[model samples]
Each structure stands twice: as C-alpha cells, then as structure tokens.
Target: MTSIAAVTLEVADVAAAERFYSAAFGLGSQVRLRASEAATTGFRGFSLSLTVANPATVDSFAASALAAGATSLKPVTKSFWGYGGTVQAPDGTIWKLATSEKKDTGAATREIGEIVLLLGVDDVKASKKFYVEQGLTVGKSFGGKYVEFATAGPSPVKLALYKRPALAKDVGVPVDGSGSHRLVLTGTDAPFTDPDGFTWESASSLTPAP
Candidate 1:
C-alpha cells in the first residue's frame, strides 16, 4: 500500500509566502532548496515544500484552473488552533494549509497519531461490515450511529464513522459530505485527506500496543 507522507501545496511565491507563514504562525527559519527550483521549508515537526513556478506558469495554471471551475481562497490566517490556508480546485476539490509543530514519537510524547477522518455514511451497518471484512478491527461504538475502527500495519490509521446528521451536530457544522477535514495526530504523523475523498492518516505510533 502507498502510505502518505506529507501533503504538498502549490503556492504563489516560495519566499514571500514562506515569510508570511513564518511571521503569521511563528514557523521555523529552516528552508531547503530541492534539485528543482522548488524549496522545501520546515517548521517544528511538519514541513511545507513550496514548489516555485515561473510567473507565467502560475498565471496560466490559475487561469486554466479557474476556467475549469476552481475557486481560490486566501490562506488560513490566525485561528484558535494555528495558521493555515484554503483553495478550491477546478473539480470542486478543496485544499488547506496549516502549520503544525507537534511530532509523533509515541504515547509518552504524544497521544493520538496521524490524521483522523470523520466519515459520514448513509448506511453505518453496511459500511462497518465492509471495513470489517477488509481486516479492520472495529472498536467500541461511540453511540448508536458512531463507531471507531483501528488497523495495524506499517502506519496506523484510524477511521471514525458517524451518521451524517450526527457528525454535523457533534462538529457543530451543517455537515456537507464534500467538505475536507484535515487533522494532525500525536506529534509527528502527518495525516491528510486524499484527493479520492478517502481520509488518509500516517503515523509511527499508530501501531497496536503490547
């Protein structure tokens, strides 16, 4: 299985945007230039690699993306949690950027690891059965319509299921199935939402405990 590492975002200008992030979120000064013109920047634990593109290229991509139905939003500003940004793709896909310093070391260093996806299912029973057949051990039921599933492998990932309506109430959101939810578990794990709509979380501490 192809496990996820870090989600990369296409930014306007590497240095300017990076500076903005650093000042806005107090990010670290560490920045690395890849073989390409792109630069990889790091914060405390997570990293943001700004791939530089020519001005013309950026304009062209933006135009093409907007033409294809993409809507771009300003990056995430100061929030109760941290700093981040957002963008809507041509296919109505949404992307977010945030500065996370937490690292996933273990139980001693962190609690939950990797990304946690809250999925809304039309049929909880059917979805639960499908995941169970796939080898995932379903954990305790949160309530009547919510449950937790844990899988052990190279990287531990958690899949939390909630009734669409129930999840909305828990998160205090209107509950749009198409919305994106990004989460950082523990300290080092970088779990993110995949383009295919399946939430993916990766973590070293996610393995089962003895």
Candidate 2:
C-alpha cells in the first residue's frame, strides 16, 4: 500500500507560511520548506483540498481560512457535484474547502474530514498512467477530467490529477506560469517525476550522500 508520508511546499517566508497554514487549515507549522526569494513566483500548478462532512462544515472552514489571511478565489456555492469554495493561501498556494454532499447534521462542524492534493497536469491521461506505473491504486477516474488515487495510511490526504485548464477554472486562477510548484510528495519508493513535472520524493531517500 502506497501512502503519502509528506507534502512539502516551497515558501518565500517559511515562518509566515507556517503561521498562515496552521491558523487557516489547522495544519501544523512543521511541514514547510524555506526557498530562496528568487525561487518564489507564479502558480504552483496544484491546489490543496479539504473535504469535510457537510456544507456547514465547508462554510465554517472557508470562513476560518479567510480570517487566517487567505484570499477568496471562489465564494461558497452549491453545484451539481457539491458545496465548496476556493481560496489562495498567503504563500500563493490554492486551497479548496468542500463537501461532496449535503447532510442534515444541523450543527456547525469544524473538523476537516479529509485532505487532498490536486495536481494540475498538462495531460491527465498520461499523468495518471505514470502514477499507476509508480504503484498507486486508482480509486475514481473520469477519463481526462479527473482521477483520484487511494492511499493507505494515517494521513487522509489523497493524490489526484486534473487537466491544467480545468483545475485553474476550479480554483479560479489562470493556467500559465513558471515557478516551482513548491510541492513535494514523499512515498516509500524511489523519487520520480510524472509526465506533468510533478515530483514525488521517496521518504527513505532524503539522506545526503557522504
């Protein structure tokens, strides 16, 4: 079973990024990587998604993120698929807070039920194939539109892929840029890049050679 052990984001100010993410998403501040000022620019080609139990939870999470310094990209709305919204974190990383279906829980919920890292790929099919070759099991796939992989572990963050334009539209951003996506995925295997240039690093391969 392949599990995503860690996801690293390159940030101009690691300390500030840490604070924003922690306060906004309830994520800890220990998972950030400091990058040189010259390395921070443009879209990172991905978005982090948090899936809660219901619509009220989604709204609450979105509001919390905004209060924590996130810029609203898309206001919360109910669509055929579900209820959700998009926000850009202080470090320029896009985030989507959503729920797949409406529930009558009738109470405000604040806990995040799941997390996902959605990659914007130039070619969805090709990128999906590359990840499959890397030993990830496919969960749900929508041909060239979207694909989700199943991960087995404590972290609930799943890996997914969507076309660049479609992803940009979902996150309310433009689909062109050049800069480190500022993302790092760690697994229990060798490091590799997908067809779309997204890097997956090995959890056990972080040691520097002597």
Candidate 3:
C-alpha cells in the first residue's frame, strides 16, 4: 500500500508560505520548501483541496483564507457537488475548500477535517498507470477524466488525477505553458515525474506504516 504522506510546495519565501498557511488553514510548518522566485511560473498543474464537514465551515474557511491574504480564484457557491470555492495561497498553491453536507450556521475554525492533493494530468491513464506501478491502489476511476487512489494508512492527504483542461476549468485557471507545479510528494522510494511533469520526492521519514 502507498499513501501521499505529504505534499510539499517549493515557494519563493519559505517563511512567508509557512506564515500564510498556518494563519489561513492552521497547517503546520513542515510542508514548505524554499526556492527561487523563478520557481513559480505558468500553470502548476495541481491544486490542494480541503474537505470540511459542512457548507458553513467551507465558507468560513474560505473567508478566513482571503482575510489571511489568499487570492480568491472562485467564490463560495452551491454547486452540483456541494458548496466550496478556490483560493491561491501566497506562494502560488491553489486550494479548494468544499463540503458535501450543508449546515445553516456555525463558526469556521482553522482546523481542517481532511485534505486532498488533486493533480491535473495531461493523460489520466498514463499517470494512473505510473502510480499503480509505484504500489498505490485505485479507489475510484472514470474513463480518461478522473481517478482516485486509496490511502495506505491514516494519511491526512488523499491523491487524485483529473484531465488537465477539466481541472483548470474547475479552478477557473488557464491550461498552458510549462513550469514547476511547486508540488512534491514524499514517502516514496525515489523521485520521479509523471506524464505531465509533476515531480515527487522520496523521504524516509514520510514512509507509510505497514
């Protein structure tokens, strides 16, 4: 079994990224990497998603992220799937906050119930195959458009792949150009890139439990 133990972002200012994420999402400081400003350009090819227990929590978190300096990519609204919105963190990482359940009133907390790393891949089939070879078990999949993988243990973050254009459209972003996705997946044995150039890194500390 395999799990995306963590999703690390390469940012221009590690300290700034750490501050924003902690203030905006209550995430800890371990998920950031310091890199040159040139590291972020063009489409990142992926987005981070936060799943809460209800719609009120979704809106609360979205508003908090904006107040904490994130750019709103999409506003909170009711959709076929649920209520949610997209925001770009200070370091160029796009985040989606959503929940299927609806609640009329409640205060939003910095705490998140779950997080998923969504990859926008050029070829879903190829990317799926690559991860499968790396020992990740498939959870749910649709023809050439979306696929979900099972988490190996108590991993906080889940992983999924969707067609690039569809992903970009969902997040209200353009799908063009080549640059670092600013994403890194640790807990694997070696570093590698998928079909669309999303990189993954291996860290022994992140290895999943048996």
**Per-residue CA lDDT of candidate 3, range 73-139, in tens?**
8998988887889998888788999988655456665557778888998889988998899889999
Q: Indicate which candidate wins on lDDT.
A: 3
Candidate 2 local distance difference test against the native: 0.79
How do the residues 70-149 of candidate 2 rate in per-residue lDDT, one tens digit apiece? 89999999988888999998878898998887554656567777788999988889888878877788999998889999
Looking at candidate 1, what is the lDDT of residue 172?
32
Candidates ranked by lDDT: 3, 2, 1
Q: For candidate 2, which ten residues in a row score worst on lDDT?
A: 29-38
lDDT to native, each model: 0.38, 0.79, 0.79
Candidate whose TM-score is highest = 3
Q: List model 1 lDDT by residue over 1-210, tens digit each.
A: 222222223343445544443432222322211112332221111112111122232233334334444455543344554433444442222323333422222222111224334455666776677555544577657544877776445433345666667644433334444323222232134444332334434545344321
Once fitted onto the true fold, the runs of candidate 2 whose alpha carbons sit more than 4 angstroms away are 29-33, 36-40, 205-210
Error of 2 at 5 (Å): 1.3
Pitting candidate 1 against candidate 3, the one with the higher lDDT is 3
For model 3, the superposed segments whose C-alpha errors exceed 4 Å read 103-110, 205-210
Q: Residue 113 of candidate 1: its Cα lDDT?
A: 24
Q: List the residue pairs that clash in candidate 3.
A: none
